[model samples]
Target: MTASNDIDALAAMLLVRELESALSAREDCGFQLLSSGQEAVAVGVAAALLAQDQLLCSGRSIAPALARGLDPGRVMAELIGRASGPCLGRGGRGHLSQPSAGFFGAHAVVAGNLSIAAGVALALQARLDRSIAVCLFGDGACGAGALHETMNIAALWQLPLLLVCDNNLYSVSTPRAAALAPQRLSDLAAPFGIKACTVDGMDVRSVRGAAVALTDHVRSGGGPAFLECVSRRFASHSTSARETRGQQELAADRELDPITRLEKALLLEGALSTQTALGLREQVRARVTAACAFAEASPLPVPDEAFADVG
Candidate 1:
């Protein structure tokens, strides 16, 4: 990875760590955890995107917004249901929208954002500009009809859209082998004539390389692309999930932790020192603590205001 890519990877890792810490410590709502082990997807993809590009995140992940540099304080506020959040505390963690930052928001329904991303790409195509839309979903969503329909239209219209699947090997508790038929999720795009590939989601550099190449291809009018990132989730599917997996499984998953992998790579490459790495982790922890404090101090949304944003 380039120097800038290395730095971006570090930022993404730190943001993921901080978000996880904040969510675990949050006592309010039972919001889903951020994409724990899948930080590289958001970081790498967002790094390749232009300011005009729109990013749509999955329901179970908030790492995309943080990767786009959205303020953690606002993110925490949303999780805590504070009025100061990006959605004015209405959407919570599952539906964070910061259009100014090109974060289109996350969708809670499986494969729900795929069609919306295609529509956004259609609008971008109509504008005759180079802007693109990126939809981030999970492996579980690959089987959804909406994804198939969206890919069909996206390819037919040749919309500049990038579909990123965070294939963490599990759809909730069911393994990918049980949920998806095709060995590779990217293969689904072949029927639509869209360029598709799978990447090592645990490696930030690998993800960045693929994302940059694919985004450039789409931007240059090569049609849409699909990237399947093979990674793992370190936490339960959600707060309500009854199965946490066995301790051995959790430990095995952590062996591929993106943060640790990147840290070791950077250290070996002389890009970061051990002391600096520790300091960065500490800094992120402090930032998360402050953001949580800010969220706690903020007022709840007014009862009458709930009817304001409603259309």
Candidate 2:
């Protein structure tokens, strides 16, 4: 990787870590930290997308928003329920939306954004816009009818869409083996005639390469594509749940942690020095500290404003 790419990867990893740290320390509100294990998927996919392209993120994933350049302070503010947040403190971390950054929003319901993404793709096609729509979801969402219906329609209409599935093996404590029928989740796209592939989500470069190729195809008027990234969830599904995986499994997953892998790769390639890496991490932590301060000092939204944006 080039120096710039190495820097981007480092920044992405730092952002994920800092966000998790901030979320973990918050005591005022209960917020979920779902981006810990899935940072590479977000950074890789976001790197391959154009600035004008739209992103529809799943509920558990907000790393993409940060990768796309959303303000860290605002993101932290949102998670902490401050009025200055991206969602005016109403949606919190589960429903972050920054239109200027081309992130449509993050949805809480499984596969809910799939249909929304299809509609966005259709609209983009109608306007003859070259911009594409990318939807990020998890393996659990694959079981929902909404994904199937959206995939069928996107394929039939040749919509410019990319379906990115972060298959982290377990869906809220249930092993994927127990929930999914097919050995490969990407196989679900075969019946719909959409080209699909699987990649190592723990390797940022692997995910980025697949994302670039698949998105290029979709941008060139090919039907939507599906990419299943086989990853592992290193943290609990939510703050309230204990780690369900055994110690052995947790250790095995940590062995392939994306942040660690990327750091090793950069060090070996001479793209990043240990001191430089430490500095980058410290910089990110400082930013996160400031973001927390901002969130703490920001005022709460007035009760009268609750129904203002309802319509």
Q: How many backbone clashes does candidate 2 have?
A: 0
Candidate 2: C-alpha RMSD after superposition: 1.2
Question: Over the stretch 30-84, how does candidate 2's per-residue lDDT look in tens digits?
Answer: 8585688788998888888888899988887568778878888898888777899
- 78-104 in candidate 1: lDDT tens per residue? 877899999998888789889889899
Task: Give candidate 2 misplaced runs (Cα > 4 Å).
Answer: none
For each candidate, the alpha-carbon lDDT, in order, equals 0.86, 0.87
Clashing pairs in 1: none
